[model samples]
Structure formats: C-alpha cells, structure tokens
Target: MKAVLFANTDWYLYNFRRSLAMSLLRAGYDVLLISPDGPYGPRLRELGLRWEPLPMERRSLNVLRESALLLHLVRMLRREQPDVVHGFTIKCAVYGSLAAKMAGIPARINAVAGMGYVFTSDQLKARLLRPVVRGLLKLALGGEQGRLILQNSDDVKLFRQAALVEPAHIRLIRGSGVDCGKFAGNSPRKNREGATRILLASRMLWDKGIGEYIAALRLLRNRGYTVQAMLAGTPDPGNPAAIPEQTLREWVDEGTVTWLGHVDDMNALLASVDIVVLPSYREGLPRTLVEAAACALPLITTDVPGCREVVADGVDGLLVPVRSVEPLAQAMRQLLDDPALARRLGEAARTKARNYFDERIVIERTLGVYAELCGPGQEARQRRYG
Candidate 1:
C-alpha cells in the first residue's frame, strides 16, 4: 500500500511528521511527502521518503491562483494514485480533500491543525471569509472516503457546530507529535542571583500573542521586576498575521524583549531557559509548549483550547486569559520569583509529556485512523490499533 501526506511546508513535514512517516515506512507502506520545496525538503529525502513539490502560496487570496492550485492538486492525486492521502494545515486539508475526492481516491484524512487566522481573527475580512471556509470544509470533508483529524476537541466541536463534519468522521489526535526522549530535562543548573530567563518561541505572529508578550515584558520591567525575556523566533513573511521585522527590532531596541530570530536548536535552548511562554490566540497544539514540557520546563500560556489541552491549571503550567497582559505578566511573575514552584511545575510537565504527549502516542493513533479507514485492507495487522 502507498501513503501520501500533504503538508504546507517541508519544514513542517520534517519537524512534525517525521516519526509518523518512519512508522508508516516500517509498516511496509510506501510513504510519500507532498509539500513546497525548501531547505527541509532535501533533509526529508535524506530520511528515506519521496518528496514532491507543489507550488502553493501560504497567504494568497487570488481566485485564479487558487483554482489553478486545485487543478494541479487534482492532477497530482490522479498521478500518484496512493491508497491513502492525509493533509496537514488548513489549505492543504481543504485542497487535498477536494483533490483526492476529485481524483477518486478511496481514503482521505484532513488534519485541521488549527482553525487558523480566518476563524481566529475578529477582522471583517476574516469574518467574511469564515462562512466561506466553513462551507468549503463542509463540502470537502463530506463523504465516506474522507475523515477529519483534529488536535483539539474545541475544533471538533466548532466543525460540528458549523455542520462541517459529523462526529463519527472526526478523530481527536492531540498533536503532530513530540519526541519525549529527545527533549530531556536539564541536570539542574546552578542557581543565579540575577533575573530568571523566559522564552517565547514561535513564528513571529500577532495571533501567537507576540504583542501581548512584549507588553507583559514591558509591564515587568516597569514594575522593577528583573526578568529576562526573549522572543526566539523570526518573522514569517509568508503569514498574513506575521509580526513585522521593524516591530520586532523596535521591541529589542526599547528593551522590551531580546529577539533571538530563528531558533535551530530548541532542546538546548529550552534547557537553558527557566520558563517557556506561548500566548498564542489559538493552536491545534503548540509544538513549542510540548517541546518545552518534554524538556521539563515550566510554562506560561493562554487558557485557550490547545494550550489548555496540554497544560492543567497550577499543575504543569500556568494558564492566563488570552490577550491579557496583566495576567500574563503575573503568571511569569509567579514563576520568576518562586524557584521551588518553577522546579515543581517543570518536573510535572516532564511527566505529562512522557505520559500523554509522547510522539509514539501520536504516531500510533494517527496510523490507527488510517487503519480504520482502510478496514481489513493491506495495512499490517501489527499496528498498535489492531
């Protein structure tokens, strides 16, 4: 049997679904990756999967381009003729599902990583586009051959409420996955008398709460709290909600937060930091927080769907209201001043990562979804689902 996975970017495919690809390959299925070519594309090829580039814009609104993309996807699906096709991210899921249906593929899975900017935004364009996307998803995700995979129950409920997908067709897989063993906890660094270091690692987007994070940091500084905060991500020029380079530079210049730009080594970086923060407006599941949890780092995040799913109140991390700078600052304040509490939360986070958010769990569950759709077909019987 053959499996084709569609992702928006090669980096996302590599960073998120490598384990799943290996798992499928080990199960004797030919695994192929469909994504835009980038630096990470060759790396995926090196890892023993076939890479096929598809020209898809990340934030384009042109009707002609999108229609052309859909046609190209249909042609590719017809050509590949794989037994299974799974799509990640919004555009891929919507387009892949439709293309697969058009190509007469028997099995389809669309992973709605998040509702994305359209559903999350309060702007008029987003509000106008919301119903259109809902209508498209409802049409694209319908039929016996198609299934919807979501990371959070909130998204599932939203889809159902919008009449997008039936309850039976949706699978609640927590995250893309994170390697528990790879992100091991630190060996307790020496105590310092200076400021506690906190990090916010995500693509520089306004919806990821970069603005709120800076505000919180500024609040801390104004209150005479000596906490070192860093924004360890680069601006995403492709995203509509991206934080501009000028704004990021101004924050650094104004002493609001240190900008580390793009981070390559998250494990090592998480180890050095005392706390991790993700004030994202929404997510399927924040991979950064999961990695931080695996690294046994305490978290300060928004009390939204994906964030709440990974963290319990006062257990492994602190959850604050979304877009609220005071509470965000207060949560960071709690961790920075209380070393013992931070250590306790970090340890609990590690345990949570091991017990629940491990990559193995995600891979097995996803493969099971594939198996369920395939029935007693060519899939190996030894899969964890079987």
Candidate 2:
C-alpha cells in the first residue's frame, strides 16, 4: 500500500501527524510527505519517510502561482500514483484533492482545521474573499472519492450550511490528539517568590489572542498581583496573522510577562506551569489546550466552540468571554488564588484527556478512515460508485 500526506508546512507533519504517519508505516503503507521544505523536513526523513517539498505559499495572493502549484502537484501525484492521498488545512485540501483527482488517485481525504482567517477575520478583504474560498472548497471537497474531516461540530455545520459537503461525506474527528501518559502531572515550576505560574503555548498569532494574553498580564501586574506569566511558542512567519516581532519585543521590554520562544520540551514546560491558557478567537480544537489538559494543567479559555468542547465551564477549566482583558485576568486570578480548585480542575482535565483526547484513539480512528478508502475496500468502493 502507498499513501501521501499533503500539508502547508513541514512542521505540521512532524508536530501534529507524526503519530498517524508512523502508524501508516507500521500498517505496511509506504508514506510520502509533501509540504514546503523547512528545518523539520530533515526530521521527517529521520523517521524514514520520503519527503517532497512543494512550493506552497500559505498566504499567497497570486492566482497564477497557486495554479502553477496545482499543476506541479498533479504531475507529482500522477508520477507517484499513490493509492490514498490526505491533505491538511484549506490550501492543501483544495489543491491536493484537485491534484489527486487529476492524477486518478483512488481515494482522498481533506481535513478542515478551523477554516483559517478567511472565515475568522471581519475585515472587508476577508468578506470579499469568502465567496471565492467557498467556491474553491466546494471544488476541492465535492467529490465521491473525498471525505471532509472536521474537528468541531460548528465547522461541520458551517460546511453543511454552505452546501460544501453531503452528510455522508462528513466526518468529525476532534483535534490531533495528545499523549496522555507522557504528559501526566509533574510539579509545576516554582521560583523563590512562590507565585502561581501561568503559560500560553501556541503560535504567536493575533487570532490566537496573543495580544489579549499580554494585556491580561499587564492588568494583573497593575493590580500588584504576584503571578508569573509566560508565553511559550514562536511566531509563524508564514501566517499573516502572526504578531509582529517588533510588538513581541516591545512586550518583552515592558516586563509584564516572559516570552519563551519555541520551547522544545513541551512536557517539561507544561509540568512546570501551574496553569495553561488559550484565548483564541476560534479553533478546530486547539492542540495547545488539549496537550495542556493532558499534562494535568488547569485551563483558562474562551467560551467558543472548540474550546468549550474541552472545558466544562467551571469543571475542568474556567471559560471567559472572548477578547476581553478583564474577564481573562479574573479567571487567571481565580485559578491562582485557589490552589484547591485548581488541583480539582487539573485532575478532571486529566480524566477528560484519557476519555476523549488520547492520541492512540485519534490515530486508530484516522487509520480506520484511511482503511475505508484504500486496499480491497477501494476496489469495492470504485465498483459500487463508478
């Protein structure tokens, strides 16, 4: 068996889908990864998978360039002739499905992870681009050989309402799952001051509520609150919504919070933080929150779709209004002031991780999706549908 996974970035394959790719290999499928070559591409090679760097622009405005990308992918897919092709994010899903279809690949999978800024931003440009994006998505996912996978029910409804997918073609598999055992609780990092430690681990994107986090920290600092706050993760230069480096440097200079850029030891960092928070405006089940929960860290997030799925109001974490600085500060203060409640929430979060967000469960479910589309099943499906 042969499979190809297409994504926008090499980091995505390494960080998010390594487990799934490794599973494909174990199940006896030769895996080929297609993405823009980056530092992480070599890491994927180290894992024994063939790598092909596609010239995919994450935020491109040129239609000619994108069409060229599609043509290139089609030629590659036609040459490789894989049995199954999986694409992540909007561009990859759209272009990958088109390329695979043109190449006569038998099965295709497209993952809609959060719908991106095209749906989230309220700017005029985004509004104008919606119809075009919708049209492109319809073309990408509207086919017998493809299945559209979403992380949250909200996104599922959005696509269904847009008539982008049929009920039979839609699948709901929550965020790329996290390892429960590896992230089990460890003592949080403490300094001599014995202050509560809070961390936000995600790309430094405005939509991820990075600015709101800094504002909340400033508010806490003004109130003379002695809590330690850290922002872990680096800005994604490819993403248009990424916080400007200058702004990040300004925040660092202000000294309201510490910025730990790209902490490689995620488990250790989570173990060391008393609380984890993500004030994202929206998400397709943010992996940062799930990983933080798996590490037994109490969560503080907005009361939005993907976030609400993981937190039960006051049960496993506190839910605050989106984009509000005061409420965010209050929620963090609540967790910091009440150690007992924090512990209860942390424990509940771990239980939730085991029940719903285990990496193994997600991998199995994804493999099952792949299985239904490939091998003898592929022949049967083709005969039945063709």
Candidate 3:
C-alpha cells in the first residue's frame, strides 16, 4: 500500500509526523510526503523518505489561487495514485480530501488538529469565514472512504454538534505523539543558580496567551519573585494571530521574558527549565506540554480543550483560567513556592505521558485508522454501503 501525508509546512511533517512515516516504510508501505517547500524538506529527504513540494499558501484567501491549487492537487493525486491520502491541519485536510475525491482515491483521512483561526479568532474576516469554512468542511469530510480524526473530546463534540462530519466517522486521537524515550530522563536539569525557570515553547501567537504569560510574569516581578520566564519558539508569520517580531523584541528588551527563538533541541531546552507552561487559548494537544511531561517537569496551562486533556487539575499540572493574568500568576507562584508540590506534579505528568502520549501508542492507533479504509475490512465496507 502507498500512503501520502500532506501538511501545510515541511517543518510540521519533519518534526511532528516523521516517526509515523518511518513506521509506514518499515511496514512495507510506500510513503510520500507533501508540504509547502521549506528548509526542512531537505532534512526529510535526508531521512530516505520521498517528499514533494506543493504550491500551498497557508494564509492565502485568493479564490483563484485556491482553485488553481486544488486543481494542482487533483492532478498530482491522479498521477501518484496512492492507496491512502492523509492530510493534516485545516487547509490541507479540506483541499487534500476534495482533491483525493476528485482524483478517485480509495481512502482519505483528514486530521483536524484544531478549529484554527476561523473558529478561534473574533476578527471580522474570521467571523465572516466561519460559516463558509464549516460548509466546506461538511462537504469535503463526508463519504464512506473518508475518516475524520479529531485530537480532543471538545473538538469531537463541536464537530458532532455542528454536524460537520458523521458522528460515527469521527476518531479521537490525542496528538501526533511524543517520543517518551527521547524526552524522559533519569537526570533532569536543575537550576543550580537560584530562580525557578518557567518555559513556554510554542509558536509565538497571541491566541497562545503569550501576552497573558508576559503580564503574569510582570505581576510576579512586581511582587518581588525571582522567577525566570523564557519563551522558546518563533513568530509564525503565516498565522493570523502571530505576534510581530518587533513586539517580541520589545518584550525581550524590557526583560519581561527571555526569547529563545526557534529552539531545535527541545529535550535539552526542557531539561534546563524548571517548569513548562503553555497558556494557549486552545490546542489539538500541544506537543510542548507532552514533551515537558515526559521530562517529568511541572506544567501550568489554561483549562481549555487540548490543554486540559494533558492536565488534570491539581493532578498532573496546574490549570488556570483562560486569558486571566492574575490567576495565571497565582498558579506560577504556587508552583514556585512549593517545591514538593512541583516534584509531585512532575512525577504524575511523566506517568501520564508514558501511559497516553507515547509515540508508539499514537502511531499504532493512526495505522489502525488507515486499516479501516485499506485493510480487508474495506471490501466488506464497500459491499455493505453499495
């Protein structure tokens, strides 16, 4: 069998789904990666996987351009003729599913990581596009040959409530998965120097609660706390909620937070930090928190959909109200002042990571999704539906 995985950026395919691709290859299935060209494309190729660049603009709204891109995908799919086509994220999922159907592909899988900007943002453009995107999702996501994968229960509920896809077709997979072996370690890095280091590693987007994190840190500083806060990851220009480069620079200049832009070595970075936090307004299950969990680091994240999935309040991590700076600061202070509590939470988090978010478990489940469409059961499904 041949599997084609598509995402908006090569970086996503490289960092997030490389293990899945390798697993498919080991299983004797041909795998081809599709994404917008980037530096990571060569890195993916270096891994002995086949990769093809597609003309995809993540934030583009031009109807002509989008139509042309759809045509291009259809043509490519016709030529490649893969047994299964799996698309990740919003745009890729919609377009890949439509193109796959147009090209008469046998199996289609669309992974909606999150509702994304259209549902998350309150801007006028986003507000207007919400209904239109929903319509497109409803149309493109249907059919016996297709399966829709949602990361969290909230998303599954939302999609079911909206009737975007058949309830029976929706699959709940937590995340892309983390390599627990790579992240888990016996010797976690300790801050020998004073000051509790709190790290939030994710794309620097306002929707991610970056502003709130900074404000909370400021509040901590005002209260005479020696907490060192670090922001790892760069601004995503393609995202509507992306923080401006100047804004990040100003924050760094003001010493509100240390900006470690685009960290390549997350394990090393996680080791150095004392606590991990991602106050994202929402997520499809942020990998940063999972990695932190594997590293046995205490976590602080908002009580939102994907964030809550990785944390149980007062169990594995601290949960704060969304977009509230004071409550966020209180959580940070509680963790900072209580070393025993932090250690206890960190231990529980690692246990959760090993049990749920490990890569092997996720990869196997994803392959099982493919099996629903490509395995011998597919023939029976076709006969029953026909």
Candidate 4:
C-alpha cells in the first residue's frame, strides 16, 4: 500500500516524523512525503523515499493563497491516488485531510501534535478565526474513514468537549517517541566550579514562556545564583507570538540569557548543560523534554498537557504553572541548589524515557493504527516488503 504523508515544511518531516516514515518503509509500505522544500530535501531523497515539493506558506494568512494551495494539493492527491493519506500539523490536518477526502482516499489520519496557539488563546484573532478553524476540522474528520490522533489527553478532552471532533474517532499516542539509545544517559553530576549552565531549546516565541524564562533568569541573577542561561532556536518572525529579535538581543546584552541562535547539535548541548528547561505555555509532546530525559538531564517545564505527561511532578522533573516566573525560578533553584536531588531526578528521567518513550514503541503503535484502518492486506504488504 502507498502512504502519502503531508505536512507544512520538509524540515519538520526530517526532525520529527523521520522515524515514522522510516517505520512505514520498513513495514513494506511505499512512502511518499509531501512538503515545502528545505535543507533536508536532499536528505529525504537520499533515504530512498519519494519527496514531492508542494509550495506552502507556513505563516501566511492570505485566504487566496491558501485556497490555491488547497486546490493544488487536491490535484496532487487525485494524481498520486495513495491507499492512505496522513496529515500532520494544523494546516495540513485541516487542508490535506479535506483534499484527500475530496480525492476519495480510502483512509485519512489527522495527527494533532498539539492544540497550538489557536486553542490556547482568547485574542481578537483567535476569537474571530476559531469557529472557522473548528468547523473546517469537523468537515475534514467527520467521516468513517477519518482518524484523529492526539498526543496529549488535555487536547483530546478539549476537542471532544468543544464538539470539534467525535470522541470515538480520537486515538491518543504519546509524544513522537524519543530515541533513548541516541540520547544516552549522562554521567554522575558534579558541582559546577562557578557557573551553572541552563539550556532552553525552543522556537523563540512569547507564548513559549520566553518572557517568563527571562524574568526568572533576572530574578535568579539578582538573588546571586551562579547561573547562565543559553537559548538555542531561531526567532520565528512569521508567528504572531514570536519574540522580537531586538527584545531577544536586549536580553542577551543585559546578560539575562545567552542566545546561542540555532544549533544543530541538541544532544551535545543537552549533554553540556546542568539543567534543561522548557517554559512553553503548551505543547503536544515536547521533543526537548524527551531529549532531555534521554540525556538524563532533569527538566523545568510548565504544567501543561504534553509537558506534564512526560515529567511526573517531583519524580523525573519539576513542573511549574504556565507563564509564572516565580514558580519557574523556584523549580530551577531546587535543582541548582542540591546537586544530589538533580542527579536523582535525572537518573529517574532516563529510566522513564527508556521504558515509555522508545521510538520502537511509537512505530509499533502507529503501524497497528494503519493495520486497524486498512485491515488484512497490510500484513501481506509488510511481508512482501520485508
């Protein structure tokens, strides 16, 4: 069977969905990836799978452009005529699912990695646009062949209560499973001679708790904590909630946090850090926390859906309320002040990640979903592919 996966950008497919794609390939399915071109376009071609570039504007709200893109996608779906069409990210989930349905695709899977800013906001834009967004989702996933995959229960509950999706069609899968082996365990924690390094890896956005993190850092600095904060990720100018470059630079100049900019080596950076932090307002399942756990680095994250699922309160890491610097700082201090506690938490995190967040488990569960949707022929295809 041929499976065509559609998402916003090629980089997202490379970083997050590569495992799932490879899993599909190994299971004997013809895998085709559709997304806008990125640096990873060559890499995806090298993987021996078909990569189709479909121009998509990641941040544009232009209705005409979006409609044109949707028509283009519909044309592609009709031409490809895959057995199943899998959609990722918010835009793809809505538009791609609709196009696939229109093209008479047999099966469609809409993976809601996170609810994202649309569900989390009450701003003018959200208030004006939410009903349309929710309605589109309903139209896309209303049928029998549609399956809605959620990464966190909170999002599932919200969507169900809001009547955006039927409860019966929803399936919960834990965050894109972490590669425990790739993010190996860390050694025993040793006291930092003078400076303690804290790392935050996320797209620089206001809603991602960037402001709160900076406030917490300032508070810590005033309190004379031997700490230095480093941020790794590009500032997304397209996102409405993105942090301004000038503001980020001001913080850097003020010694609030060191902007490492975009770094390719997250594993190495996590290894070097004393503690990992993600103060994001919300998430589907934060890859940063999973990577941190795999690296045996204790985390300081918000008590939101995806973040809470991974960190068991005081077990593997600490959880603070969303957008609250006081609680964030307190959690950070707890880990920094007592090295023993941090080490204990980190060790526990590694164990939990290995047991629950293994990539193999995710692949198996996803394949099972495909089997349930497509029925017996999937096994035959798997055998043939093997």
For each candidate in turn, the TM-score is 0.95, 0.96, 0.98, 0.95
Write candidate 1's Cα lDDT for 216-271 as tens digits: 88888888898788989887777778888999898889887889988888888887
Q: Which stretches of candidate 4 lie over 4 Å from their true place?
A: 377-386
Candidate 3 lDDT trough over 10 residues, lowest sum: 183-192
The collision pairs in model 4 are: none
Residue 135 local lDDT, model 1: 82
User: Candidate 3: TM-score?
Assistant: 0.98
Model 4 per-residue lDDT tens digits across residues 1-386:
88999888888788888889998998888899999877887798898868988878877789899988989988998988787889997878998888887777757888989876677776788778778888888888766667888888898898899877778988888877878898775553475465888989999988778889999998898898969799999887656778888988999898788999988888778878889899888899888888888888888899998899889889999999998999999999998888889988988988888888888877788777887667776446434431
| Model 2 regions more than 4 Å off | 185-193, 384-386
lDDT value for candidate 3? 0.91
Candidate 3 residue-wise lDDT, 1-386, digit = tens? 89999999999999999999999999888999999989999999999999999988999999999999999999999999898899999889899999998988858899888889899999999999998999999988998788999899999999999999989999999999999999757334555687788998999999999999999999999999987889999999899999999999999899999999999999888888899889999899999999999999999999999999999999999999999999999999998888889989999999999999999999999999988888877667756652
Q: What is the lDDT of candidate 2?
A: 0.86
TM-score of 2: 0.96
Please provide, for model 2 over 111-177, each residue's C-alpha lDDT reduced to its tens digit, 9 standing for 90 to 100.
Answer: 8789788888887878898999899888878767788889988888888888997778898998888
Q: Which residue pairs clash within candidate 3?
A: none
Candidates 3 and 4 compared: the better one by lDDT is: 3
The 10-residue segment with the lowest total lDDT in model 4: 377-386
Q: Which is superior by TM-score, 3 or 4?
A: 3
Models sorted by TM-score, best on top:
3, 2, 1, 4
